[model samples]
Target: MRQFFSKCPVCGNCTTVTSYKCKSCGTEIRGEFEPNEFNNLSKEDLEFLRTYLRNRGNLTKVAERFKISYPTAHSYFNRVLAKLGYLQSESFHYAEILEKLEKDQIDFSTALSLIKEEKEVKP
Candidate 1:
């Protein structure tokens, strides 16, 4: 048996998955099946998410624990969310607004207004 590295040949992306084959029966399956979200994450991302969760979603604490800057920790959290498919480029800004609203830093009306303003600015 040989081990295959899960990476893209052209782009060098690391999110590849292995296919299974039955040599005896000549049965084969190409491409990756639907796996859990965590499986799609790299080892580094998984470690970051674990530490972030351990810090109770506190980016400041996570940064202190990891000895990284707050912005770096926050970026890692966003990257993990993106890898898990919980975030999309178009929705990230809105989601951040929602998070601010949840934290009571921004009122609901302000969030709605911001969303409207964004929609108006969209080309």
Candidate 2:
């Protein structure tokens, strides 16, 4: 199946869906519809997301699977989070840091440093 282009070829702008058709029922809907954020993700980003999910968000496993460093995997993970609108103005919380440590996404030292940094910023 051919994938629809989410971006306009000429202007390089995001394209909006104006219509949809059903293959079997011969039904059609026409209106201005916004594409989801997933549509904005590149093929590589999707692949990375898939790999990360398949590994259950374990950065160590993701790094090993991609033959990259742990920090690199973490960086890629953060980038995906940003693309998905998960990383807003605030940094990761203390619970999130502990969760990452539990999931082996970050080492104990890294988690500690992040917690320390967060503490310093807040207090």
Candidate 3:
């Protein structure tokens, strides 16, 4: 089976599921059903989310599993958070934090604490 996309590929607009069918009973239902949050994510994003969760929200483990740098994993995490409407990009200095992390100026725990402090300050 293929993944269901919630956006129109041609026009890049949101698409609604208009119908459903039961394979066992052959019963059909139709409506303008909104896709869930996970449905809005791409396959790669979903995989990243799953890995993050499986790792119990440990970015270091996620990075090792994905064979990416810690900073890159952090960036991917922020991107996912932004996509899910949990973060406002301009509110945090993600680039600076990532750069600092990459340069070994700050550890992961410190970087996370800084981000958490910023979030609390903003909201």
Candidate 4:
């Protein structure tokens, strides 16, 4: 697929969509149109989101699809959620973290750090 740029090529900053055209009729519309939110993500982020959606937002399914650990999959999911403005950096899925802690998959200190780290990420 051809990559559509969401950022200004020269300045490396986000670009505004100023116009649109009809492909078949040659009708044109010009204005400050908002770009698609998905366009803001990179190729990798898009693929991750595709897989995540394909799995119905199941973190375990996403991990299996990616052939990765749950924590790793969770990290990717969280990153995308943050980028899309769907998640606050200071917030987390606490139940999952607590479950890991109860199972001894993560120690108390690591669990605390994980929770703390989320708050440290600027919103």
Candidate 5:
């Protein structure tokens, strides 16, 4: 059986499903079935997502496991997050760090030191 292509061959528009047929009994029934979104994910993206989850969202561990650099692992993770609509802005990261500091999980001195370091790194 030929797999259904999502795009029309002639015009490149999205192809619509109008009907369905059973292979064994020749039974037919169909109208407007939604394709599963998961079907749209490439195998490599799925594998990356799986490995990322398996590593408990640790980029360092993921990099080590895949023999990639930490920056490469972080880039891949950020790309996936962007695809999934979960990417965070720099402001959001700063807010999260502030929240951690407020909760006493990070010391105020450490937070101030990081802020000073970030300022120094800025052009």
Candidate 6:
């Protein structure tokens, strides 16, 4: 099955579903319907999100699965986060923390604590 985009490809404008169909009755209805958050993600982004969730949000594992580097995975993850409005660009340095955590210089708890501290210090 093919997927329809939730945003216009040309102008980057948001899209709305305007039709509905009933499988049992073969009836169709049309109206403006808001797309859900999942519908807003592209197929590639959705695949990345699925892999991310499957690996328990571990970017290292996600990178390994995709045969990409950790930084690449971090970039994709950050893009998805921004698309979902959960994060903004330059909001936090995930790649730095991931590198630190991977080198065993700091654990997850310490990394999270440091992130929290950084957020506190930011205006």
- Quick one: best lDDT, which candidate? 3
For 1-123, candidate 3 gives per-residue lDDT tens digits of: 766988898999988999999999999999989988778888899999999999999999999999998878888888878778787775337756876788899999998998887778775
lDDT of 1 by residue, 6-65 (tens): 555578766545577887998988985645678667778878888888878889999898
Error of 6 at 35 (Å): 1.7
How would you encode candidate 5's per-residue C-alpha lDDT over 30-110 as one tens digit per residue?
798655544344567668888888988887888898887775666666666655556755434455556567667889898
Q: Can you list the residue pairs that collide in candidate 1?
A: none
The TM-scores of all predictions, comma-separated, are: 0.49, 0.67, 0.70, 0.71, 0.46, 0.62
What is the model-wide C-alpha lDDT for candidate 3? Answer: 0.85
The pairs that clash in candidate 6 are: none
Top candidate by TM-score: 4
> All predictions: root-mean-square deviation over Cα?
7.8, 6.2, 5.2, 5.0, 9.8, 6.0
lDDT of all the models against the reference?
Answer: 0.75, 0.80, 0.85, 0.79, 0.69, 0.82
Model 4 misplaced stretches (Cα beyond 4 Å): 92-123
**Please, what are the lDDT tens digits per residue for candidate 2 over residues 1-123?**
678778998999989989999999989999999888888888988899999889888989999999987866776677777778887534535556766786798999999999888778874
Shift of residue 32 alpha carbon in model 6, Å? 0.8
Candidate 1 segments whose C-alpha is farther than 4 A from its true place: 1-33, 91-123
Instruction: Report how far off residue 41 is in candidate 6 (Å).
Output: 2.3
How high is the lDDT of residue 55 in model 4? 85
Better of 4 and 5 by lDDT: 4
Q: What C-alpha lDDT, on a 0 to 100 scale, does residue 105 get in candidate 2?
A: 89
